[model samples]
Target: MTTLTRPLLVTLVDDYDVVLTGLAHMFDDYRDRILVSEIDANAVLHDAIDIVLYDSFAQPESDHEEIAELVANPQARHVVVYTWNFQPELVQAALDEGVHGYLSKTLPAKELVEALEAVAAGEVVVIEPKRRAASAAGLDWPGRREGITDRESEILALITQGKSNAEVATLTYLSPNTVKSYIRSVYRKIGAESRTQAVLWGVGHGFTPDHHRIDHWLGGP
Candidate 1:
């Protein structure tokens, strides 16, 4: 591991406040190594940031344009994608966009800090897939308190946006069968009998994203 003179200045980027806040707290134990400078939803990047960790919750995994925009930003020294999806195409696409790291959400806080330290030292990091029974702790998402896993909530969010199962699978890099399985789980947990009812429930809850990160950052309409 690279020894830093000081803690690396990091920023968390995502549309959901809950998700950002949870990620920020995950590094609380490793404050000496990695300092979360800010959690941004729509704010402009004014200060210099060593790394910007883009959390890919409820977002299309293949949105390379947004990643490219982030890479082009001068204030962001390095960009890293923090996500659960590890499809080879998605990884290659993100790397092609000049991302410094493509990390998994399944990584624990300590390992996450280590990965960031490696990125700070100018090494491109790509976390390999592991057979994890559960994702890392100290993370939160919309409807998590209501027993909805992050993946399930993401599926519901896409469904709320009127995405068909096939579209959801495409965007999330999951199989169509996996998408259906997640939908079934979501319906069971939310007491919904059909797609319409599930969409209604998702609408009532916080399934929709507040704004797109790049648009909000660029102050576009």
Candidate 2:
């Protein structure tokens, strides 16, 4: 007798219903490799899902907290971000938030399935390594080489934008607690004791809006 394994169950999440529907169709031919079990902005998994793919379209930075929440979901074993934006900072931020895979939207349907399968098998996959490398090379913040991560720099830049913690939470989709934690880490790295001082340090160290284009990419006001 031979044992037959079940297909990997997947959930597709996106703000747009059209995107969810399209993704479901894209995976139709890969029924053996994976099953599109659920498709909705708020995907409620009735059963355990092997992978939860979050489509960011063009706004990857704004979805970080959502990705973190999905990764922490009880029903989600693996979480992947499917996006057209391959900005290194966004990719690094997603990975730091526990996203299992970062795949380009331009990937062929078959390749996307394979990447998801790899993620389901406990592998971290990221397409567009060249772009990621280029983005990383451009991260020359004053404290970046001193151990501050890409995520920290992003939060610092947000602070410089005069965004309150709650506003930051809304923009970054992170909880207040998580935003505060990141703030603490940023403060420690830059040796700032207050938000005002941190903002000053960020301004003085080149963590400015001109350098951090997250707002532009995310279409923020």
Candidate 3:
């Protein structure tokens, strides 16, 4: 049999032991190719883990910084977060942190498995649009997202076309960090909280076109 090398490693943290144990078990079946570790909240893993599924442990955690740090790490290219609930703001925060995948505690095992593998392969996974957000609270772009200068708008348009940041940096002749910063600023200004949100808001506001049709975002500024 052809064996997969390097099991996908995961770390779990939660206040409830039972919950942590159950999670460890659920993912235990992949032991041969998926190593699972349950660790204390304060642990900063020395070896690279395939993903981390965590919740409150010893203290109230700061979400964005942690997620961003993981994404920023060369070893954490495939960071995935699993949470008990999907809060739009929190979920968006993870996206801004460059998280690769996220699934609510209620996601089906089959789907979760697919998501884990996808993220491990370096693809980002997005959750379903929040019910309320679709109804009304979705997002609003009051004016041009504040931090984005004119040059940044040009870059944002490129990303909307599915271009990678590196590709954008090459095209714009700007540094990768500059591109990332622009995206973050756009997110902040539009109350976007996420890349998807930034895209939706930009398209909604006329920075990017719908591409579905020729209708103006809000039919005009």
Candidate 4:
């Protein structure tokens, strides 16, 4: 593991306790590169922190206000969104909101730490341009039900893509409780009793990826 002369003090902001715990474990191996000081969904900092890492598993746009709030906090000198949803417009919006970095969740742990270190040193970072471009092209879920809200549709799309509630919370910038509520609503609307059933229903109703774009999005040769 690579070590930094001064490890960045990082606080993770996510809606799920399990997600926070998992991230803490991932960073624990690189003690010399980064220190996981605090984890909370509200971006509260008990002590001075060098970096605030916001994990967006699926909902980047929805979390803009929270990101802006964290950026305005004096304790957060650097704010980065570590996300799987790489819509270019959303990334640009985050930058506009004063985010220091927007990085892909696909990045290896070491690379993520390095990105945080760079952000702490007063640099703006964005990883995986091609993926962001492909994402910007969009991942649409057709055949939506009549009453589902846009946010519900977005969460349903991610659910069909096989994301857990915790993952969904991270992606959508929603609290896990919020994610669960959305899921329940989606289930009632679609008549799904379980995740597997929802996924099956989504597939039957056109919750599918554009294969051509997916190939490019995954960096396939």
Most lDDT-accurate candidate: 1
The list of candidate 4 runs beyond 4 A from truth reads: 1-4, 58-60, 129-221
Clashing pairs counted in every model: 0, 0, 0, 7
lDDT of each: 0.82, 0.66, 0.54, 0.67
lDDT of 1 by residue, 1-221 (tens): 35569878887787776777788888877776776755444466777788989998888776676778788888898899998888888899899889999999889888999898899899999995586435689998888989999889889989998999999988987899989999989988999999999999988888876653332221111
Q: Name the top TM-score candidate.
A: 1
Candidate 2 regions with alpha-carbon error over 4 angstroms: 1-4, 39-44, 58-60, 129-221
Per-candidate alpha-carbon RMSD to the true structure: 4.4, 13.4, 18.0, 12.9
Models 1 onward score TM values of 0.89, 0.55, 0.48, 0.59
1 or 4, which is superior by lDDT?
1
Mind giving the per-residue lDDT tens digits that candidate 2 earns over 124-161?
99985433222221113335565776456556767887
Expressed as tens digits, the lDDT of each residue in 1-221 for candidate 3 is: 12235666666544344345455555544555556665544445566667766542211223355556556666443667765335566567777777777765455555566677777776788755344221111111223245554445555666665667888766555589988987787667668777787667655555543212211111111
Candidates 3 and 4: which is better by lDDT? Answer: 4
TM-score of 4: 0.59
Poorest 10 consecutive residues of model 3 by lDDT? 212-221
| Poorest lDDT segment (10 consecutive residues) of candidate 4 | 212-221
Candidate 4 C-alpha lDDT tens digits along 30-126: 7766767545445355566788888653333555777888888887888898766666678889999999999875666677777888787778999
